[model samples]
Target: MQKELLKWLKDVGELDSARLISECSVDLLYVDTLFEMSSDRMTDLMDAQIGIPGKYYLKLQLDFQKEIKIIETQLMEVATALGMHIRSISWNPKIDTDKEVQMKISIIVRQAIFDEITLNKISWSGRLEEPDFLNRIFDLSKMPSFDSRFDNAYDDIHKHRIMNYDWEDDWVFTDRRFNLLHCEEEIFLKFLSLTINPVSRTDDEGVGQLIEIYNRNLSESGIEFYEKSKIAGKPIYGYREIAAGNASTSSADAKQRKIALVVGCSQYEFAGLLENPLNDAVAIKQNLESLGFDVMYAENPNLKDLKIKIDDFGTELEKYDVGLFYFAGHGVQVKGLNYLIPVDANLKSERTVEYDCVQVDRILSHMENAKTSVNLIILDACRNNPFERSWGRDLSQRGFAVMDAPKGSLIAYSTSPGKTASDGEGKNGLYTGELIAEIKSVNLTITQLFQKVRKAVMEKSKDTQVPWESTSLTADFYFNRK
Candidate 1:
């Protein structure tokens, strides 16, 4: 059975070499496997040995990081036919000082099938015997019966991974396996059943139909497989074209209609001046413009000017599907209400803040009343409150107050509520600098973009500062898409 399986794997180009090693009583199977293409140089050394009377140890070492879930799925089918139950699987990175990193996967299995005559004599000195039925399982003629579309699909996925290698921090080996299983569920299920239960009613016609359905679903999902399959001269199903059309429509909708209002107050009359607000605003304006937004930028705006700009922004929002508002400067919260301080505001007491500063609620009202489909409010204004000492009240808060996002809107704070964010020694603040970098990541969705920004800020601040957000958006939004 082992020999036949090894031969079939070799014939199918799944492995580069296979050998049976006799080190002890039981025969050990060692195979060198390859994935995608030979040029990738990703090799796996699989060692299968019976360590105990009924238990088996399977150790796999890969020369480079790649998906092993497919291998695991195949092995599970093999074990099920042999009446073996997998106990556990573990993964570890084996690092060498002189060489690149290698990933090691170890799996333990225990046998459940018991025939007294066949089981009692299974010892440590000879090869474990397999029943005649088990030995006939690996029929070479049945190998090509499995769907071939999976080969192309997986190749496309691998190529996509290679193309995005530098920016894909989230696409780990685990993610690849997950996408494979979810994206090609029917094909994999049919393959597994055919391999393990050959006597079942699986036919070529049925398998072909399953492959067709799988192909249709993959195309509709807008996954890498669909794009690659098109280049390979394969016919795309109906739903894929529909999905592609919808995507095109969305892109056209966003092209010239997205709007953003950026306000940065650096010079204050009563509050201390900040050096980074103007620079942050300029950088943000450039980034948004690059992403195809009509930006309204303001620097050193007073209370009256801020109100007029925000009101104008509200009027502009009515004609757009996406609206974004960004503010960078002094901010404070009194009595649990957040306010953005202008450059010319003079807050004599807590009572004066209501009339002197811009209320965050009012800004949100502009977005809500404009009826935009998506609204993004970014506040890089959570610096230390400069008027806290002069308030003569218990208004000694560190930063802005926490507020809930209205429906279809997302509000992001420079730092956690009530926590002061850093104005970096560099030209831009910590949060905004990280945000600027992440916004330019073409493939990331808005949520993913913010997650990367949060991670960067935390790491750069050494855990001293953390960004926070409140979101009620029902649909996904991306700054840049490909």
Candidate 2:
């Protein structure tokens, strides 16, 4: 049986079979002995094997109790064949012997992809042995003339569009290569659902083109798009950190200071929720900049832009003493996993989610590497899920569930879990309205101000909603501790 199972596994590409066979151990064995082989040479061993079933298969009569044992044995055999290491096993004698023994099993495999795959850490390079410099030209079969290319003679022409043909092997090619490299990086990074770090490999021109390409691609899908610009004269990065007791600015020349990233993504990114967060992100940039910090602010950014913002924010994090993130829009927690809704996210199926939408952990992972003094993740994106129908189909437990926030970080939710918050029948939602009203109060500390904001919003909503927070704060945090 082991040999057969090994062969089956080997025929496929599943190398895990070898490991399972090496640690082979039988689990959940049941038996009712009644052996009758061809001319029992086991007549002497027959009496002893009466209560105990023999290991080898022979003429076995499966009685009521015997059939139950047979079924259990078959289940164990199947489990072993499938390369499952059983952690626990059980048997039931009370179950009806005449009734068929059903096998219901669950298999879980934990494969570590993030830790094992050293992404973006390795750079690839290759040099061609020789160059074909004869200017190899192909026969332009059924192709159009260069003169009438655009409209007249090119209706059915399938061609590779090389925008900058002159830049194939020159200085422009080098720049274009960098641009293409950044573009490729953006594509792969999107696959991993990570933000791009702008400063890792500095190419202002390359990155700018990359952003243009990303947005242009997104626009083809009928999605409305906007790219964040630098504030005043300074460029904006995304969510970052500062020490709790520290100020965003110092008394120094302030010219040497680098502002943190203030990035926001509210996939629920409704036109309604857009203005407040965008305004809030802008206010955050201005407030931080006034204190001598160089701010990188992004609002309602799509996935690619968000990744770029995150990457840029990460690179700038080491240069700053403070960081902050304020997201206002629609967010949902499914099976305890949080997701930031994008404006175009129509997640009707679970299969489409990881690719089409953004996961909160991806955002947090980018921030996890920040070297700043404080990291504050403020999520104002707590509203009822639009895909409420999906919740019922995929979950036993309803509503969004909380995930463990990263350490040394303070996470504030717009509303408490399992509770729905108002979408602001007026201009801003109740939460954002209160937040905007309270955020500028220099008299209050960050935490105290949050408490006040939470109280006010809760009271204003008539106890229908209440804000929540989860913090693993190492020290005190204050917007104006001094």
Question: Which candidate wins on lDDT?
Answer: 1
Where in model 1 is the C-alpha error above 4 Å? 1-250, 392-396
Candidate-wise lDDT, in order: 0.60, 0.47
RMSD of 1: 19.6
lDDT of 2 by residue, 255-313 (tens): 34345666554434332334455555565566666655666777667767766776777
Q: Which ten residues in a row have the lowest lDDT in candidate 1?
A: 104-113
What is the per-residue lDDT of model 1 for residues 1-482, given as tens digits with 9 covering 90 to 100?
23333444455455522222111121223243345464754333333432211122233334312224433344444544443333433433322344522111111110111121123332111221211221233332323212254343333333443443442322321132222122233332233223223233233223222323333233323421121122233322222223445678567645747999999989988877798999999999999998899999889999899999999999989999899999999888988999999999888788988999999998899999999989999999999877777766553467877899999899999999888899888999999999987898855557667766887999999988999888877555778766
TM values, all candidates: 0.54, 0.43
Q: Of the candidates shown, which would achieve the greatest TM-score relative to the real structure?
A: 1
List runs of model 2 lying over 4 Å from the truth. Answer: 1-260, 263-293, 390-400
For candidate 1, give the lDDT.
0.60
TM-score of 1: 0.54
